[model samples]
Target: MSERVLVPRNRGFLFLDSHPAGCRQLVADMWQACPAPAGVLEGDGPVALVIGSSAGYGLAATLAGLKRAGIRGIAMSFEKAPTVRRTATAGWYRTAATAEIADTAGRDLVFLNGDAFSDSMKEQVADLIEQRFDGRLDYLIYSVAAPRRTDPATGAAYASVLKPIGQASCTKTLVFDDEGVAEVREVETGPAEGDDVEQTVAVMGGADWERWIDHLAGRGLLADGFATAALSYIGSSLTEAIYRQGTIGAAKAHLEATARNLNERLGKMVGGRAVTSVNGAAVTQSSTAIPGIALYTGLLRGVLGDGLVPPIRQLAALWDQLTGAAPLVLDDEGRIRLDTWELTEDVQSAVAERWETATTATIADLADLDWFHNEVQRLYGFSVPGVDYSAAVATDIPWPDHAP
Candidate 1:
């Protein structure tokens, strides 16, 4: 037998793998470490399933929905690697943490590890629902994000490319290597052809969401009055050329369209409804991968640190709407409204103006780049409070439900 290689884990952080007992301890610690947000619910619900439910706003949404709706049981699907070799995705650690918390609370939880876009995965999920749940699901959340997806209709695999709307554009980005500020410029890296746009839309957009809903409904697995939701975002114009106005934006537009169709389909099913929550900007792994968003998010983080509304608070608010604690306001486009706050006239105006006037000496004052960097790091389980950074650690935490 060959010798096993040890991969380095993020020591002194919550990303470390904990065995079953350690996982349990970590859950209890986090519960005590963070206070429940104001107005959180403490009850039990019908049942909920959070797809792509491991990290970023999705994870937060899952927790908030459960806490507020009193959801008793949850079935989640997360695409993550094993922690044994330390090569696991960050979501692997996060799912472990979530499972530990749910178990400690006596909430019945079943976690599925696989690609949510796969048809066989849906069958497996349906079977799990029938066996573990009482053949019905009350709440469903679609939150998967992939750089590439195989189109069900065409059987073609397309990779999403992020680029500016027009000619080359350069912008300043925060550099953590340099103590305070540095100028990082980006140009359009790829051409977004018409077919590329359509293919990207088909793969990453709303078709998968529709398929999931149809599958559940056709199988009679959705309960009466059930609700399904998908989370979307529209960033500021500073980054919109690469995001909202570009290929990804086209995909999001399609996603919003799917929401309308799902609403009608669900309405005809059992008085059920479908909702799409246009969420606020946050420093997520996916967000970081998008060019220019890092700079935008860093600036927003600085602004937020100065007492502006944070993404977590915004997510909590979205959860409130999901649980009927708050009403969802819609824009003229017939979509749930939230992006306006982040891409507000005032906020966008400031970022755009700063982008024009910013230089190496002036970029720091243009926005809170430092704050954004810290928040971005925090999102990855780094720079958090109460965690020591010098501890020896191992990444081989065993999955409680993993069968050899």
Candidate 2:
């Protein structure tokens, strides 16, 4: 018998096949769904500078800006390139696929792969903007998720940790193996230790985001009437201790605070506005790493099935709000809320009820664990339908060439 080929696996995460066709299909569906305002100019559209624009909300926002606003974009990300032993990260293929579509559609897209937190990378992107797309950008999307960061000036490394604030808690967490077996494991998380919270804030917080905007503004790269949005999340009370009220939560609070600060500064300086777009939770590379998220997502699916909004859908809704299709609504804190429906009372009530009674034995019945599993794999570009898994794929793919 011929050897059976399976999706490549690393560290229990199955990296999806980066077949150009499958990537194209995913982009096409999202692009078609994004509603562009009528009478948008073809060649004179807005320009967007998207930081961390490879996966999840970043990728979705990029597609929406392109398809709906007819905007040109420059995407910056830090993703792994394919090695001799394995395929590239899903972001690599997703970016390549988006570039291919942009070419066929005669849209402008430029992707730069590097450390978004670094001063040099920011400088490079600024230079690219000034040289290629004039000296101004209309939109800046920040959606980076990373565990550690190195300060460019100080060379200090900070790592983010996931822990509750007050005390240790024992919870039921989900673990997936290479063969895709889902197992519930009991996890005990302790409180953040000395400097843990501050370190996490330093790494995952708004400082870097503020720095990026400042850099662009200093260089005259922000256009008049420009807008910038950062992605944040506030899930159900089930994850309050570990997520919404934990170290990460502190970082998010800082992010929102930064948004308000930037909103004031940008409005005064360049007629720009900054807002935090509170997002809904879905299976993504970052969420699965949370201790109890798999269980919660499964329960969430059982409640919000057919109504769960993925990143792509969420971005399209955001576009509508930006273009006035929907009212520009903000939470009491002045943050844009795309998670309105996800956090509705009815949805949370249902999820809470299921969450209260859910056990490992009862999870299979109360939650759509299978659906969550597939979605997790899909985040990495695996399990996508119509993509031939057995076909040989190119490990090395180049970015689309752009002329100055």
Candidate 3:
């Protein structure tokens, strides 16, 4: 009983491996079509840690900070498990269906998988937040996307590329599968020579997000008004010469200068804040392994149709700019753009007029590549929606009663 197909790899998409009740019915139909986070908070809430929490936009900001700000999550991830010839990584059944839906809503999670740029996974997430989160954290969300990195004190490995910094360019790409848009080419890339933008800024910069906020702000486990963020992307200007001036935009401009030196050392030691945010352009899995970013996310989802804002509505507009519902803008270098409505100006002037008529016979009539192939088959939990993909299920599920 193993028929969960959709592989098309060369670093773009992969699935054929995942079941556990169809990845817990796509994480219970994405938190039953997630919503509740416009505003809500009533004391003793925040905890979150989330470093690359299993899947895109770090699993939608770790399920919008534990189902919309009732915070208390821990997450981390490297992924892949199930055996006897595979079936797991749909982020290990989306972290065992986010610990069986945060233990049936009595909310609390831990789920660390490993190698979160190791330092023994930051002292195993600061000893599981000092044995079950009382040692304090408030929020730290880094959202890593590895390709290679290994310098936990000079083990020196580093590898991340995706060329285009100063020469060969071109554009228009699509050619996907898993049943959708199998055409549209042009392609070129090639650049990022020599120390390839310093090994893709030592494998996607922000130096392991300032070494996990300097080891959770030196283990006194950071909390006093604490807040930290990382994710970044610049988009538009037609993937500015292969993504914001290439080499992963010089590793997102050294992760926006390591989020202004982690917001001036977590605001002079503990009034805390270290933002960066940015994000937009959806279909993740590290933006479909980037090369003209899946034809600019299928012409920016055909110019933001349904005002395109996935990644759980951009992590609920970044948890409504970290709970205030406003006043947390920042841009001219102070980062946090949150893709300000995916860079409006009429969504980059209707995606630069469908990027000069996208080709391969007008990309299925101008891009949306079937909503980028059903959002890469709903990021590999397989075209979810009340599941039941011919039921055969079970492939060793369990693991996540605060897994570690």
Candidate 4:
């Protein structure tokens, strides 16, 4: 470990650094709050592979599985390792801390830090699965969110954009600082141009999810009663044009379509199942990057207050549904609907009323802007309750050596 002190450096809403102890504390807190599964899932416990399992809902889901049920997991993500000069990404610290936590409970969490979208990485995961945790996987969770993806077959790169499709969109969004709500402005974005939608879909859509399942199936690595689910979102009409009907929306549509196809494919392979879960909005790194979501989520938090189901709760509910503790609550498209509480008629009406009249002057009253800042800060391991911000921290935490 390098002897260095780290504080969160903000470039607008994105954080430049992460704290290792705070990250561990955050995971420990989530573990403490997450309840155990009501019943056994797929046997005593499942060996799960969580692609993109470092942050947000993915991390929440991973923790839920580990604490609620005895899930020995393999996670994959591409996070920058720390050097003597620069600190590691938040995900890197999060993954390391979680592995350490897992060890105390006698649970194993093997992490493969590499490009999850590539065939070579998939091969590495397969070999590890075969050699380490029994040669079969019971559960797979796809939760990758990134701005760019390179096609493994053609070596072509595609970058995803968060812009509207078909028509331009303009809306009110928040721009804030550590103090409180700084400004509220109308952010306008142009429609997707040539190849924008396609590229975004290629980067964010279900092609990779299909690829993972196919690779695992081809290798005869999928266990009986196998189940897979990919996380998704269908936003409210408050920011529909720029979100649910935008370039990112097209990618989500393709993802849902792939889930349908994979549902059938998994059934044929091992009498297994696949589903896409439409989760509620939380202040994730991906959600905060969208044009007008900052304002929306703040208002949402204010209106919903304690009523809003946190990501960990929602994920734990998902685990229960998948494991027969409860029935799956699906929408018309056969996708799980965990966003129901977030999109309730009462909640949306309150938020929409606030959206119409919220200005820089009244944003504090109309929205939980400070809460948004706090959540965003917590995502990068700052703003945590028990962390020592000014003290010297061991910045360069090494990834655990868990080779199979």
Candidate 5:
């Protein structure tokens, strides 16, 4: 066996190994806690396809569709396969675990692992839809978050950057160390140079999402009255400099524009709808890498506590709206605003006050770093209650069903 034990090393807050059992337990918990109401999903045969379905909002959207909406889901993800020398990525474990449980419950969901930003992958999913989904896709949830994406046509890989657009930004942020200790530090980032914004948009923008819809519709796989949602974020003024107004912001803007175009296209073609769901800030794998989100979410957790809505619940609300159980809640820009709780006047006022006074000492009181840190660990299958970390585990977990 390899040195698969979870140990403390000098890698800052970065964790490279994952626990398979822990991941399974977390998935099981979500499956049990998730609310599933019959007759809410509306249709006789509801189907969904989730790109980047292994973790975070992607995973939440997948589960929300399955449990909340009663949809048959096909999860498309690219996760590294586990080998004897090292553990697979947490997403790999999560996907495999999810498949095992779905199988046991006789629920309909399958995993396809591969690069999603490629034409071949798109065609492959189309074929899967033909075989498994009766050739009609009712929902497409595009929640991909990657550092780089290789253009399927040109083979040019564009990496997304988190820097601001016009000027540099210096803000206070929180970072966790190897000992799981949290500290506040002043981090400076921004002012995209060169073709940074263009590259970011190229990688993170709506072009790929549009291409997917185009391909699916062209292949006659989109169901009548189909719907698609691309997950996005429009943070508060606290982190807007490095987020909403940053290079990533340009990418998100392009994503929203593409949604409008796709909405028009879908309406004309199939009576379908496309929306960019402006989701709230939460402790996600991608959000942790952003400049100011850590501090923002920390204060958010402290101020809101139980008032804060989890991404999964928000996604369930998305299902409710899409299924006609509720009306669509939109902002003036025509995007769904699930972030009203995050940007509330009272909550933001408290967070703003905390941000002003937050420091190495006061951060513990003003911000909930412990909560943030624990949530992050839960993503990687660590810090989960009742998991025996000392016991040896198998790394060669299979897909438990169909493979891509």
Candidate 6:
């Protein structure tokens, strides 16, 4: 009889597949990257709630605030894919690593898996906040991105669409070739329905943030001098037709407006303020998937690597503003503006010139293509230092503090 070989179950898809050692290593890395300042909140400090804290800039914000402020308790909501394959989102790995590090450091971290758009989830979250911290929260962060949302009142679903403002348009994009020059044209799909835009606003906008604040305040679970912030982005006009003028852009505008409303309402409660940080554009998982952006990002990455300002640098600056190291500047729209620095007149002019007169010969002069490709890879947790690619990673690897 032939001997049978058994294959280990693939569980990385369900969880982050994080090991205690890896988690510790990650914490050590992050600590070294951004060390805590003296006299900051320390030793089992204030509680922070991060909604949509699974991936992208949201995860980055969570890490930044946690490290800077020495926050000890964290509540996070993340949507995970249900599958048997090893497809853990980056946020899952980050949360697992954070929980492990916090446990060893004598901190408190709670992670909840739920749909943030649902009412039941909000109630449960409110209950958790009241029960855990004696009705007091110090900080709140809202960052959510979704393709579609169902209307609570109408029982109808809305799907967001990306397109130009007036009519159909085509744009050039990057393609893989030996010469690093290829043209991929894209057409604007069309405008989404008004209801669709409204639904998208409801799901991705500040409604959840407001709910969190209202519930916490009504329940007397908010600490003194609390602060809340949400992230916003305004891409360049070249891509704005498909981004800022589209359904998603409408939702963002609503989110920004909601932040002001919350600031007015929540400010009176605990001497608090609600602010929105205009963040930089990067090749995040969400941003890369948007049409025409990958090409622009590829170009931008190349240009920014040569002593030019990049979005990550902008994020660092945003953190400085949040920590009171610098002042935040606002535009006429009552929204924080950072994209102006990123898509400056000179930068956009240069990219436009390149776009018009670029060919195989012009591609080399555009910028370092290699840097652009690597940044995209880094977004997926690849090409990061300290990770061993040679060894086979286990899917059901145990986190340091995972109960099960």
Number of clashing pairs, model 4?
0
* Residue 60 Cα positional deviation in candidate 5, in Å, after optimal superposition: 0.4
Give each prediction's root-mean-square deviation over alpha carbons: 4.6, 2.7, 18.8, 1.7, 2.0, 5.3
In the range 43-105, model 3's lDDT, one tens digit per residue, is 647788888877888888887677777777588888877776777678888888877777776
Residues 70-170 of candidate 4: C-alpha lDDT, one tens digit per residue:
78969878899887667788899999888887788677788889999999999998988898878999999899999999999899999999889887899
C-alpha TM-scores of all predictions: 0.84, 0.93, 0.35, 0.96, 0.95, 0.81
Identify the runs in model 1 with alpha carbons over 4 angstroms from their true place: 1-44, 73-77, 82-85, 152-154, 165-172, 175-182, 306-308, 400-404
Give the per-residue Cα lDDT of candidate 1 at 203.
68
What's the distance in Å from true for residue 215, model 2? 0.9
- How does candidate 4 fare on TM-score? 0.96
The regions of model 6 sitting more than 4 angstroms off are 1-32, 35-43, 81-83, 104-106, 151-156, 175-188, 306-320, 323-329, 338-340, 358-364, 398-404
Best by TM-score: 4
Candidate 1 residue pairs in backbone clash? 43-70, 44-70, 45-70, 298-372
CA lDDT, every model vs. true structure: 0.65, 0.79, 0.77, 0.87, 0.84, 0.61
lDDT of 6 at 112: 74
Model 3, TM vs. native: 0.35
Residue 224 of model 1: what lDDT?
87
Better of 4 and 5 by TM-score: 4
Give the CA lDDT, 0 to 100, for residue 297 in model 3. 80
**Rank order (by TM-score, best first):** 4, 5, 2, 1, 6, 3
